[model samples]
Target: MDEARDYIRAMGGGLLIGLPLLFTQEVWQHAVLLPAWKILLLLGLAAIVVIGYNAINGFRADATIGEVVVDSVEAMGIGTIVAFVALLALGRIDGGSSVRDIVGHVALESIPIAFGASLSRAQLSGAGDDEGREEDRRGGQTKSESEAGRLGPFQRLLVAAGGALLFALNVAPTEEPVFIGVGASPVMLLGVMALSLVVTLALVFFAEFGGRRHVSQGILDRPIPETIAAYVISLLVAWTLLWSFGRVDGASVVAITGMVVSLGLVASLGAAVGRLLVASGGEREDG
Candidate 1:
């Protein structure tokens, strides 16, 4: 049951994630040209992506079905990884004491990998999803206060270490881009940021609609708290892979904040739309 759920979540994210680099231009175009339409459409898409992501991980918000969650909640971790990689590649990955850069980076750079991250989430989660969550439930481990009994000792240690590293990086990022071939350019930097926003909007709508419709009412007699589990698992995956691979030239907190907000609103709208569509579709069949 757990494995099935995990596979389903990752598969859904992969399918929903748009073609790599395809939406990057669109993100930039829409942000400047059609802010209103882009915002609305983006919100719808983001909502669906998040909703579908959560459902695939597990219909409940407190269970661990896979290594990653397609929802925005887990996407936070994915975004972290992508931003890390983006800045690393940009030769300017910074995690300075300011929360502003974190938000900026998320908005502009994170969009490109939003879908890819979602798609790759499954691979990252793998077996860890089951064993870690299972142990935490049985009182076999203790993580942070926020995590509670969600991860085992080793996993918790890993997350803590990863967070610590992020804190250190925020103080001062190393002068190295993870991807060797990637270059730095002021214009292209803005382009990347724009692209990230566009992609995030797309994700919002997709996540929202998919999550609500697929899960439908009365589907689960008692869905576990899949949300929490999925979120926690994704954190581990993000820390391990995305963070390691994330590379970018320049970082900005305002940008990431804008992207996250844009993504979240759209996701909610998409989810509502998905539910409405599913309900209508069922009604039509019945009639």
Candidate 2:
């Protein structure tokens, strides 16, 4: 059960950070354009980053060198699979795609995904650092006291906006959202919106991530309502980013809505994880 949960979290983290880049056309082109040596170099760099990150903040609290290497390899594998599947779902690659194109696309995109997987325990979970929280407990801080340090409702919304922007900003300016929005049917857009909300709720509440104790201490704290509120923030942020990027300019309402929903999928995940991060940090400071 524990290992299953860990793998799920790792997959979630990879998607959370990697989905934006999957939508990028430049990334798709990079796969075929870069020389083999450069591609190998990029892979090496990604491996080094994953290995170093595991050495520092891996899923386990205490991992030996062998363990870290194993963890890094697993993260890389998970990331590669995530990239391949996501690209396929987005229709970026297909059965018709050449071997070089497929390999380049998957390998290039997996770097960030693996990095995100490696940071799973730190970034995706609502839980904070285990050792730090344990130290706080030993320091005589009560649970209620820790909860009191959580961001207020308004503060959480603001942080959610910031997080949404952080994740969606780069992708928003690109052509992918427009391409997706224009091509997708109304049903597809609705599906995207639904998935975005589900992802948000899962990350913020159901993931059993660390620092969850500090999540819902504010006035508007119920799970469903709060998730709705965060989703709203993500949508608003997505709309704003699209408008600013001129992607929505002179567009029909249907097209605009599609674009917003497509980008909101990424932004909503950011909002969910962002609230957790800030809540954890605030608790630690108060403790």
RMSD of each: 17.8, 10.6
Ten contiguous residues minimizing lDDT sum, candidate 1:
166-175
Clashing pairs in 2: 126-210, 127-209, 127-210, 127-211, 128-210, 128-211
Q: Give per-residue lDDT, candidate 2, residue 259.
A: 90
lDDT of each: 0.35, 0.73
- Candidate 1 Cα outliers beyond 4 Å, as residue runs: 1-19, 22-27, 60-71, 80-112, 127-287
Best by lDDT: 2
Per-residue alpha-carbon lDDT of candidate 1 for residues 157-253, written as tens digits (9 for 90 to 100): 2332222222222211122222211343445545543553344334322344223222323322112222222223323322222222222214344
Q: What is the lDDT of residue 237 in candidate 2?
A: 79
